[model samples]
Target: MRMSLDLQHLGREEEALQVAEAALTDPWVRHGDRLALQRRVLRLGKPPRRWRRPPWAASAQAEPREVVVSATMIKGAAGFKSCFVVPPARNGSGGGGGGGGGATGVPRTACVEELALLHYGSPAGGGWRGVHSEGGVWTTLWALLCWDVLFMDVPEVFRSPFQTAPLDLDTDAFLPARREAVDARLQLIASGGAPDLIRAVWSRRVGTWCRGVNWERLTLDDLLQIAGCVGGLGLSVVCRLLCEDAGGWRGGMPDLLLWRPERGDAMVSEVKGPRDRLSDQQRAWLAALSAAGVRAEVLRVVEAPPPPPLPPPPRPCAECRPAEDGGTQQGTVTTSARSCTAGGKARRRRGAHVCGRRAMAVPIVCEGTEGVTGGCTTDGTGEGAVVAAASVAVEAHSGMEDDRVVINDDDDDGSGGGGEEDQQQLQ
Candidate 1:
């Protein structure tokens, strides 16, 4: 190929054409490569007055690359579960008709016979094989289900054929054929003059899914939009797997077929996350698509809205730190327990000091011990009564312990300062 290019560059058009044509006969040359050689032959053998290069011949750098994210990773932080093929399917949550649950993952592209993908199906023998009769048993929900429409488009090159799309194919790139097949099915559905079959199908299935569709109005615009979407998949696949019917592949595909007016294209999307995952059938379908050269993507718009910002953690009260006299710094008491300064030093009189300025202890709030559990016993008299406080305590190597704090119920008729004193003797 390089030699052919060199020949063409040196103005030896006949020689370049021969060299390029010779390379085309190689059995190892890929289909895309074959097309490249054929184009070169056309260029060198007979250069047109105004030779125009098709997109495939141009450098790859000219096009913008799209980024596809992981759907399994973006499910709700609290609860995330991959999709499984649940029996009695119809596995979407919203749209009109209850498009089953959020488990509806992607389009109907891959053929599901070889493998069981993770986060896409039950790990054991549950997926596609049995019915999930218990609804609450599966706790995982895909967050993608939250959107009304999951929309993304297939690049044009992959939608139709690069050049030679075969009619009959298996495990090969044949979207052109698939498109034909879809159109055929739609034609069958609209055979009785159903007012333009393709348009009618889209009008009924696209927007008001999981609920009900307006069967009255169908249009050609919708059919074209849908045909371009599904990453180049055919409409027969979409109708069979996506549309709502009692016996449809309702439990297997995405919920909606969306159109992006700005790009003038359509996309197949499964709105997820009532809470996330593509079902096994979906995974298989995607696998089959990738094998066939179609681009399948998991488009995550953003990261779950950053989990609502976490509530900022609780702040501690100001008086819980240790104090100079073996008590809380601000002297805060917990529960019905009382606290007052009772340091065994020269008692600072109510308003007396050597400098004629009295020093006072900082006041602390009394917060009761919360988890201490025990029955309380009260004497008939209010003051000067026997009050035995038995608090529930939990030890590192023990059961609930009742620690008693007994008070003679001494009366302080004059001031409240001495009413609840920090009696170190209670410890």
Candidate 2:
């Protein structure tokens, strides 16, 4: 009985009732305790009305819930689940009349066997098998589903082969055919009569293709290759960096153009390369496009292997020296010889220093001889008689005065006065 009460407190109402009933049958419990246990079991059986109605219960009833499934989920449920395939509607007048209303619709079986023949080798089937056979299957199925849903003609359905292949895949043969088919389909869509299903399928294929290519670091050559892959579709490829002169109305270039003649529609594209080492010219072109209100982008490409580092510069000659003017000075004699041998015109100027030595003559003047007083003359014919006789006399007189002043000093003043007078008389 106590155990039953404990179970009821623990919120195990079912277990508590079972334990209570079992305790009532047991002989060990007294009658009064059994009656009390029965009362507790009854209380447990009827929980508070507020507790019975939980807030979660109300929310679960009110809120609408959704289930999200991925591609993997769809693949997992592929066999178990079935889709209703609605056949093309026939004319208004039909032989068959509606009878069973609750009957299940006919199940659709995928025509996988016919897919290889329709898409494998045909020009309409983009050579996607080389890159992604499974992806191709999905893309092709999507295209066909769109055509059937929209009641589009068979020609409009398989137009334009899907050209873009995975980078890791070899698509040499498939790419060209795929491009043609894709273009044809695109043209049909542009005709303004394509159903929404066709548009949706094309959109998915295009998105997949764009995702597959590593657009960054795509080189100009690579862009040209891509253009070639889509060339048959009437696309004109141009580098946005290139200048265009439209009858003197100069303008920056547009990257890519896909024009359709039938619909008079066009698609403009802007191609970009890796950001690393983008040249000034490329940047300017991008800026120009932005200024012109054109859409543009920057993409990255795989870095190519670097070339070998250039060999270290040759060591300078040991004998080489810089000139006093801080210029490189070579051997002067060698330089001069080379200059002369080269037949350079020689320049002449006054007071120019000569390199070789030569003897030079200079004039000298001789004074009068010793003790030769006035009136001593030189014969003009003699080599030694260059000075005039009067000039020689004046020079002799000046010399006598100079000698008297020195020789007749204070030591022999009185005697020198008489001697000086005699000398004067003699002079």
Candidate 3:
């Protein structure tokens, strides 16, 4: 391909086409290389023979499954969406629903996986228990189930006793070198021996360090549940794929493993935030899991709109008391003939007056039952209250200006009470 590029740069179009065609015809050429050569030949004005994709390439190109969910957005430092709508904390506290930190001292803004897990366990989600380990759990499962095959005696692959993995673990030589052993182990797992192998390995090497195993992530019971759900054939396909290319295929597994222990059902989920998209490696794993008969899907999260704000509190009345007929009225006024009493008759004076500081401006005067037609008035003897018969004009104003009620009393005898002393007494 480089030689063809050089030839094309030199304006030798015929030679470039010839070189690319020759490379494409080579039986040993890699599939990627063949595709490159085919494109190169077409660029140089010559069409190669009809092209076909290799079987592995076709399988790798399969589209992954996708799922989308909306999450309630919370305002906080992390701005994280909760994994569960209501995730149980590490402790038994039930305070994981708000924006503040939970009882675990960790903010309630969990990552995408937690939110997705919560969704699945909710009433709408079929109520499955889930664990989020990204690729660690699956790799650990593979390592334990095929422990013997991985640590078997191979020429020059185990030179060092301290080596956690075989020397050729990431090389192309790893699979072919131990093909027979890997095939035997996969057959054993396919025959329903997966749980036994995993249990034996866990019992034998619980705390011992190994390259792919994560001791802290999976418990014995959890591993057994996973094994039962995936079944023999599905687990075999997974192990075979991992054994094929441990280095290239190890890191892109799903983010969550959800299962219903009672029914022996399971699913794997790869979670993505609003703007996240699947990488090439992730797509490949999803495709392989689907082909292996495992329930696998990509979960995309969308932030939902927040709820409406609460209504304001109710306001307090300026002056309120129960009427004689059992209905309440404001501003010391009542339909019954009752005198307006301000702290008894000692404070009561003949005047046009306002009510409280926050009260509306309702100018009411109490002369007598004949003089007070609108508002209440005292009997001046301090015995009882009175509702005057005279019509008193009351102005309805909302706020106070300098805390003063301006009264234009037309009384000539100076008993209308608009002086500063009368204002102070009313206040």
Candidate 4:
């Protein structure tokens, strides 16, 4: 940060601004340092002001976002190896590991998480802070809390608020006895004795949470489903928030809350990206959450990477061996070791492109026999098979190569009986 200022002091205004902007985007920099750098970048500009949203999104400021995963895809092919095989994750591959690493098994999951950190970007018309929005997990956490705290029918007294709410009961009282007893907290809310307390705490955070809980996007059934996975972590997280100084903690929150459906395991997860830093508010929330016995984690999500490519299929080549009867004969009859397919017949591919057509043109190298026949044979008859393999006699031609000569078997209809035939050169 001082360096950028120094650059500016030296009359390198543009260079200073450049340094500030670059520093703002580097994730490895400490969160505090990155924020200072961001401010520096803005201040270095023509007019010093906080960053603003793009012009187009100004109209939609009033809109609340739906708390659902948007349909997305892996658009990058970088480090993309193969298509089918998934590789094991590299150690420390994905992200800063958090929580006790419980039922969430394996590092491949980490690899997946890392991939996202490396690539995800938002368009110019994206969330206020780059592409990612911090307060993302608010709903999932709320939904979980609702499930836990409202397990038994929510007391009618608790549902509606009164003038002198939370008269006697406060977080100080609630935090003492049922502090770690998740069931006790649930029972207290359900029995209606703690109406004022529940109301007070819930109300404290409701205004902030409402920003993300989009009613239009969540169906009644979806809410019901989410409610079940809402566990102890959910309840404790909100209580921790309500107990804190609201002024410091409204917007600095984690982005994701995840749960395993089968076990109902839950986590308070944060996505920390490059050039991104964990804010003090977020750290305070996490500390409070831990003291309350809630499971908290800093996690990441990423695109599944591709596998490595296979070596190019061995190039088609020929191996030759000496033939019988002195003068050589040649044909490397490569056959399938096993049937290529079963039931459905394999379609015969057309000939390789050669000889100015979609077929090979071979010359009959009549070394000693009269003539050779060629064409595919079936049921003792042939078409496109190398017919009647006869060792045709050939006068030692002057312009012949020593190694095997490639010739088309007798696929042509012409008849030349081997005696001094002007051997048309085999292509």
Among the numbered candidates, top lDDT falls to 3
Clash count for candidate 2 is 16
lDDT of 4 by residue, 1-427 (tens): 8889999899988889878777766754632344456545655664443255333232212221222211123344866431211223222222221211122233332223333222221121111111122543444333334333322322332443432222212323432333344455555434433324434544454333232344344333433333344444445445344433222344556554433344544444455432245564565455444444445555333333445787874322222223443423332222111111111111111112111111233222222212324332322232343322323222222222432333222313233222221222232
After superposition, candidate 4 runs with Cα above 4 Å error: 1-244, 259-265, 272-281, 302-305, 318-329, 332-427
Tens-digit lDDT track of model 1 for 1-427: 7889898789887788778768877865533345557666656654553255445453311221222222212223444343323222222322221111343554321111111121122323112211111111000010011111211122342344332212221222323324555455445432322224434444454443222232223234433433333223333333333221212222343333333333444332333332245544444333333333333333222222233566765433334334554434332223232322221111111211112222333222222112212211232122221233333221110111322233322444312243454332222
How much does each candidate deviate from the true structure in C-alpha RMSD?
20.0, 37.6, 12.5, 19.4
Model 2 per-residue lDDT tens digits across residues 148-232: 2222222323334553322312222222324454445545433433334334544454334432223233332323332233232
CA error at residue 165 for candidate 1, angstroms: 34
| TM-score, cand. 2 vs. native | 0.14
Judged by TM-score, which candidate is best?
A: 3
Q: Model 1 off-target regions past 4 Å?
A: 1-224, 228-233, 236-248, 269-277, 288-295, 299-427
**Alpha-carbon lDDT, every model:** 0.32, 0.29, 0.64, 0.37
lDDT of 3 by residue, 193-222 (tens): 999999899889898778989887767888
What TM value does model 3 have?
Answer: 0.57
Model with the higher TM-score, candidate 2 or 4: 4
Clashes of each: 31, 16, 16, 29
TM-score versus the correct structure, for each prediction? 0.23, 0.14, 0.57, 0.30
Candidate 3 wrongly placed segments (more than 4 Å)? 1-63, 74-107, 306-427
